[model samples]
Target: MLKHAPSSAWFRSALPVLVAWFSLSAGACGLYSLPPLEEQKARILSDQITLRALTAQAFLEAWGEPTYSHSEPMQFFPVASGNYIPRFRVPLGESPPGWDDSIVSEQALFLGYADRGELLGFLEKRLIYREHLPAEQIHAIAAQWKREELFKTRLEAPPARPPSP
Candidate 1:
């Protein structure tokens, strides 16, 4: 039998519990890293996937024909409504439009992905945004384009706090 080093004794002794813990956590991990919606859709359409794997046809069959079909290749769409937006992780909230804030508008990000030739997935969400554009329409549009181009951006989200006494 192989000898267990003292430092690694904890690991060996803990292996059974660790295995049990992992098995318990397996369910949560199932939904964590799904393939982006675009790729899954592409596979489905390409026939690498079939109706059984995805309920595409079943859904249509049950519900009747789809409302709309898309023609463009490798494109994604996000449709949303209302005043609440996603990516509003910052505590300060958004600043005036046309100025950089802790975040970008959900509309802009959604549109950007659709326009960028790919989308992570489709989401319907409420978005809140400033009403007035701080810059002229054309300039503002250009700035938004730049923001999309320079995608390495972040939004500040309020830290989760413990319930108050």
Candidate 2:
């Protein structure tokens, strides 16, 4: 009569082979390292043609991470005014130009890929704009944001104590 092994013994004997197979398969499937960033960018650009609408999560998955991300409040002028004014314009009186007493603002997220020379803007987690800018322009935009952030930080910081003479 042939003798049968216990379940525990069979499991113990097969464990090492199973582990080796899983490890080898994982490595071959690229679980150990990420693909090149340039390849990811190319894929994103190509995929975007068919995927006109992309969510923030989808963007992160495809682009990995942005070089810089900035969130700013966006103000819209009433369409009935028949004219549109830039946001930078100072309000002549208490309210902004083309803006009524009730002001509406929406938060927008801007993602910059300096290396890829791409700028993407998202509104409410949905991509609203994409542009292929020159690297210099991308750098300039990043520098401008840095300056603004520094200025904001200084303004919020406590006043420095004057040194005694």
Candidate 3:
């Protein structure tokens, strides 16, 4: 007995058109990109990260720990609002319509300061120079902190060796 071929004439035509639609739809969403570490610095520095503006605790709470990405202040979504829209001005520019709706979650890479504000580092996007330090660096920092916990006071001048007569 010969098996009948399934009716795919409609499917064949719809598939390519559907694929094209999807491609166009994706392009509308904008290209997906994660910025490089160097660029990350530039990006954050462009935003500005300062010691006074952001504390270690603010970063820790925002991120998980003070990694290269934690030095800067990150505005995460689901609750990312720009500085509480003042009581007198019309919401314009950065606070555009659905500004909060656009973002998902933002994790920042740590970078130096710009002027006085908190710098929001770039998302490392480079293929070759995706600068991610080894886990040991993070581990070593933690280990050093643990050792410091044992310290109570400064060492007393290392026994003061006498000079030769």
Candidate 4:
């Protein structure tokens, strides 16, 4: 009969338990779990748009151009309304009609900006990032947009089809 060394015996006895313990710990910590398939889908669908580190080009590419753009007076002090320019008590509305006035611009479906041209954030009900989003859901949205575009094109074209030769 053959016998395992003491260290081998310890390893054989401890390995399975160690694996089980690690698995349980990870699962308990929310690092791993097999939730229902539908629940997984729901979780992905509910993930909100994260705007940090996103750029204007990326936003445009994802949403395929904003519906519109709105511009507002860029305040020297965006947080506080009272105008005080660097130790000078510059009262609000002192600047003549269009003097010293700057504009901050943004695009819609609810995206925000850091400055005139810098994109800062986003809001809900817009096209979510397909790569960041679940494949099934994003693909579905893309298909829906394609259908809408085709419908629009058909509406703009003449009704009769050109005769096929």
Question: Which candidate number would show the highest lDDT if scored against the true structure?
Answer: 2
Clashes of each: 8, 0, 10, 0
Residue-wise C-alpha lDDT for candidate 1, range 55-134, written one tens digit per residue: 33322333334322221111121113222223321225433233322322222222221221211112221112212223
TM-score of 1: 0.22
Question: Could you tell me which 10 consecutive residues in candidate 4 have the lowest summed lDDT?
Answer: 79-88
Badly placed stretches (over 4 Å) of model 2 are: 1-45, 49-52, 76-104, 153-165
Q: How many backbone clashes does candidate 3 have?
A: 10
The number of the candidate with the highest TM-score is 2
For residues 47-79, write the lDDT of model 4, one tens digit per residue: 433322233444554444533332221222111
The lDDT per prediction is 0.33, 0.59, 0.36, 0.36
Off by more than 4 A, model 3: 1-100, 110-120, 124-165
Candidate 3 collision pairs: 34-125, 35-123, 35-125, 36-125, 48-118, 48-119, 49-119, 68-110, 69-109, 69-110
Could you give candidate 3's per-residue lDDT for residues 1-165 as a string of tens digits?
A: 759764699789889999998975553333444333354445434644321133333334333444333212234222122321111112334443334443422333442222222223332221110123356544553454346446725451224568989
- Name the candidate, 1 or 2, with the larger lDDT value: 2
Better of 1 and 4 by lDDT: 4
Model 3, residue 77: displacement in angstroms?
5.7
Clashing pairs in 4: none
Of models 2 and 3, which has the larger lDDT?
2
